[model samples]
Target: MKGILKKVYVIFFISYFVFFTSWFPGLSFFNNSNKVELNDNVKLQAQAPDYWPTTGWRASSPESQGVSPQKLQEMEDYIVSENIGGYIDSLLIVRNGYLVYESYPSHIYDANIRHHIFSCTKVFTSTLIGVALEEGYISGLDDYVLDYFPNRTFDNMDYRKEAITIKDLLTMTSGIAWTDQVDYYQMAFSYNWVQYVLDQPMVHQPGEVWNYNTGGSHLLSAILDRETPNGTLDYAKTRIFDPLNITEYSWNLDRQGIPIGGTLLHLTPRDMAKFGFLYLNNGTWNGTQLIPASWVAEATTSFIDVEFDQSHGSGYGYQWWIYNWLNAYTARGSNQQYIVVIPDLNLVVVSTGNTEYQFIRLLVDFILPSAGFTPLNLVFVISLIVGTISLSILLGFTFFHFKKKRTIKKLRKEFFEETDSNGETFQ
Candidate 1:
């Protein structure tokens, strides 16, 4: 009876240890999970996608691209159940250059539908500036902003306003005393939009302060239009739109026929992913370098401490919102439009929505955590299971052997004591 109890205890202890050690990754020695450190600058080597999404994206199962489908589904469910369904038009996730997950929440929106990306256009504009700089259409960022508008006259002209440079406009440090609250509408209604932006009094010296100025962004488009041989629209079509094969899109122009630099560009969700992918690959597309790689690094790097959305980080780049905290950058627009790039994850996410609600929670809470789960290889899995089982069996046998000897010795002692009480003994 004592031997039976010892065997049961040995089996139970070994079984418990084996069950937990093999099943739970946290407790397992064979866990191969990879934690993504976003700030790591080491880029993944250039591996071509199965096919370029010039025409359309190739869809794949999320799991195939190292993403968890259940978590993605949970993300969708959270959107619907949390009453965030109506606001979002589309959400797209591209990992390892494949469209692993896409969600069009509304019947009106679809894979091919072009949604207005608002201030996401600014990032595009910033990209075009990089291209323009590379092609020599624009000399450099340090060129005086007033040099492009030599023919135009403005109000409150001073040395400070004249001192503004193209870099300042790109960085939103042009010191234009324009406020979105009143001046944005005023500029929209003004007959000469470029003139309206330029006419604003200089409140700070160029590169002196960081201000959220859409007017400064428009001024960039104006400068590009004036500097480019055929105008900014033609330059973009030839250099950017054509290279990426983004055919179905529209760019709203001001009364002067200049493309709205700060807003009003419409694009399909897939095309938006293409742009993010372009940046993710460091401005190279296909085999050709569309925008210089150096410019890509420069454009995304944070230059100023800003007071923008805290969740998105306080750093600001050239028309790009820098989230150094997350080691990601975003082309954020009004109405919650975004093209986010996480280089370390090799992921690009695009979201377009109409309501004022920011859906970054969908990325921060759901999509990001669902990626980079490095499952153990089949060999590793099999070896771990077999090894643990063998170890458990050996440990169980040893435990039972020792337990049996101890039990037998105790039984012999008890027998001797009983015999002595009865004045009898067994050999």
Candidate 2:
């Protein structure tokens, strides 16, 4: 009876283990300290905004915007506990065109302060190119590179260099023979920045390879300067900034007085989100189309499949990183600056962190799930409930079986003792 009960107990535990593991495939409840508890069947109903955030954004509670406040709190706590609090400049989440969550973790930055958004400036540069195309300042994406700089003669002149197009530059597949780490520093110190970029020898045919070249981005800025009235900075001030009411911002210029297109644009976190919101609403701000709808769609679409070995992206669009899993896109920069837009969720997340942390992990593991995007699996829930009930029944059966056996053994021992005593008395 003891051996049978022992075997039954082992079988019960094995079944329980199998059921538990099957219920949560990827997540181990005992292993991960920060395991996500499912908020089952959460349907996000976006609340329409009362007004456009052209002048300033309206504030709303996370729950009101169909965002989980508990998840946001967990994200904040993770930042603090990870010792990333000091380096984090700002973190803001915009859902349904309202500012749902905002945190200045570093305590040094705020809504009023402008933060330097490094390579995120590239996305803005790409946007201006779209604007210029719409306004007829430039001809089209297929226009050759050499045609733009007709006055200047370039070195290593080949058919490949002549074949480079604006679209090639926009997608970072210019095929220019340049190492970003070495060449970018050299280009920065050179006398004529645009001339230096244009003069680089063609390594591969344009649009055949994807290489990160900040110099190529600067070439874009120079092109804008030539095509647009007054220059890139002035053109942006009139066309983008003033219209969006984005006042109090700065742009750093190159040696040739063209705005450094790859980096060095500063704006407040709120203002950074406005650019994201503009893209989210398909380039429309308020009732007016700030950027052409077609341009926004084309810019965010992945043109090249590149690998950065990061959670944020493995695909590249026109100056945008595509997160295919989330069906989102981001204007990502070094040191963890990002303007992530999830169209499906009607969400925009902006962060300017001086220190590098896995912001994508936060987005995927916490934020997206918190937005109630991942619904609980019905099969798993049903199995969990059934397994718990079965285990309870098995435990109760085992307990009663042992109790009944003990009772029978005690009665038999008492009967034998009485029989022995009566037999001895008769003798």
Candidate 3:
């Protein structure tokens, strides 16, 4: 019995260590290797025929060139105060292909930091759909879901399952009942995530009502894997990543060796900015039409009305979020990460923040107001200046406080260790 107990203890320790090690930081299991290499002499450059304006200066200017600086500052402050989630890592605002403003907060600012983009990975997944269709791997958006997955079975094994289409998944109207708030982290760790998602009971008829379902997105990934001769990641590397010049990145794969389409994509801020720029240019990069133009239009169009409270106010498109402001649409993630595109102003604003609701509120209340082209009021300008100064001070103090807390924790640990040694000696 004693020997058996020792064996069990050893097994438990090994399992725990393996699990933790697999999940540790800086040891991502995803593969993001670029499969295709371009000629060394070939140089790709951004081709913007005309440059956007960047004029006007005031202490609290309502607008600068096209977007308001005061409003941008206000949004920044709100994000810091709310303590959103990860970090307000990077922000870049571009107008007519010219960079207007860019910022990287001190806490999460690093050239090589690849932030996890949660469900924002859906946007990339959707883009792959467009690529597959354009490349003739997919017949059309109307192609039935079961056409690819002939062997798979659903809860309602009927013709209704046949009604599920690529478009249905993109629109989030697949009629599949799914809970987004559930602990998906545990589900991701399971050995059969694809089977688990597919086996979910159908709650309604296909395309009856709009429902936000991440599982549907995974189905799309499965479809891509089936249709393409090469693996999904390899296809993305050749078709998307190679063309965009993205070398460093990672994408999570499920137990079935399929990319987890709904979430967990890690990318550097600069590479993320490239994606934003690609969409802003209407699927064109460096004058090359990488994705079909019609697909971009269709993808950004509102397919379902989303309930946006203080946290978020946007309609859902093909894995994209369409905002009511200035006919803007964005690829957004939890905790305020966004790549907002406004076609009218020819502007693209990319902001990564930790604060959830406060960041959205700031964008609506402060950023939008300041984006107007009109002149500013004197009192408003002074207030904006004061607010900027105060917010800077607050950020400084917050960082200092966090540092002090870490110091105290280290000291306490040392003191406790000393006390434990003394107690052992007394015993």
Candidate 4:
């Protein structure tokens, strides 16, 4: 009986571990931390107009900000029905520079966990290049790419490769022979990324063709590595991330110590929205100009026309994706990670997910219509999500807590009773 009780205790602890670690039924008890908060979101929008969100995002309701709560609910429902929210870590919607909607699915993932944004890191590298220009680490985009690598010897050096400019790499028109399908993994495995990229033979003349070259992005990383004041990651901390108050983040490095520029940037969903907000505000945060407005314009504009996905996007900008939609851009990553900016709407929608679905179209379908179609009446309604957890969730947790305790108490009584009944206990 003593051994049996010990086994049962071990099982109880194991049950605790399993329930808290993964998303299982009733994990909401462990996941929910925020107490119920109720208020009108619109009344607080401009309480401090100069706010930069350096601390954290201020929560709001969609309806208070002229967004239809019902439609937002529809979008959330679609995400659940399609298993979209389950695939992603977080989904956030910001309108008029206010965070109106946010949802995190898995119990493990919360607002604080910094996620690997994957290819979305490409645009950040580009943004850093702009900072490099501002800080005078780089002279201009028209400068030769080879000039940044004077000491590194290239056996395959030629006029076409030498003609490659900072601009060339920015637009993926470096024309360097790179098949991202195969070369990306190869480059990640190799010890010397710069050499591997510089070694690739020039298949087309510089700025002649738009090829999806991951090598080109790695080259930008190498360039920043050499040219910037500190390493690229350190420079990012001071110039981009810190300025935006993105204090919690991790930039993964290659085996060679090169920070993966094309991908490998990690940020929380709210921090990612700050980046979009940075671009949306034309690189200004609060009153300071963090990135040049000119760079923001050039970086988001269609620099080249490349067809993709059978439907969206007219071309690629410096590191951003310029879609066919008016004044719209996105920083996209593999597995459907997106930080989408709609300049026309003054809106930013962010998601970090695993599935490859058009979250933007879903936005257009569900969220966008609610923003403009509804008339703005100043009446405030009680928010459905004002409480962090619903009454059912609360009751469920209470029931489960008491039930576990009662079961454990019953087990203890029964075990001792059975042991006493045996009359073989000498202790």
State how far residue 188 of model 4 sits from its true place (Å): 0.7
Reference-based TM-score of each model: 0.77, 0.77, 0.68, 0.74
lDDT of each: 0.82, 0.82, 0.67, 0.75
lDDT of 2 by residue, 1-427 (tens): 6676566566666656655764554443432222223222121223334678988999999999888999988988887788788877888999889999899988999999999999999999999999999999999999997799987798888899999999999999999999998998898899998888888998898998999988888878889999998999998898788888999799999877899999999999999999998887777777788888788888887898876526347688889988754457899888889999877678899989887877776787678777776523344455566667666766787778878889999997787789888885333
TM-score of 4: 0.74
* lDDT of each residue in 295-341, candidate 4, tens digit only: 88888878889765445567888988886433468888987789987
Error of 1 at 373 (Å): 8.4
Q: Which stretches in model 2 have alpha-carbon errors above 4 Å?
A: 1-49, 309-312, 375-427
lDDT preference between candidates 2 and 3, better one: 2
C-alpha-based local distance difference test score of model 1: 0.82
Candidate 2, residue 305: CA error in Å? Answer: 0.6
Candidate 3, pairs of clashing residues: 84-354, 84-355, 85-354
- Report the Cα lDDT for residue 8, model 1: 52
- The better candidate by lDDT, 3 or 4, is 4
lDDT of 1 by residue, 1-427 (tens): 4565566556556555655654554455543343233233533323446667777788889999889888898898898888877888888999989999888786669988899998999998998899899988899999998888877789999999989998999999998887787888898899988989988899998998998898989989998898898988888888889999999899999999999899999999899999999888887787888988888888888899875664446688899988765557899888789999877677899999888656777777688778853222343455556656666666677787888889999998998898899998676
Q: Where in model 1 is the C-alpha error above 4 Å? A: 1-50, 373-427
* Model 2 CA lDDT for position 161: 92
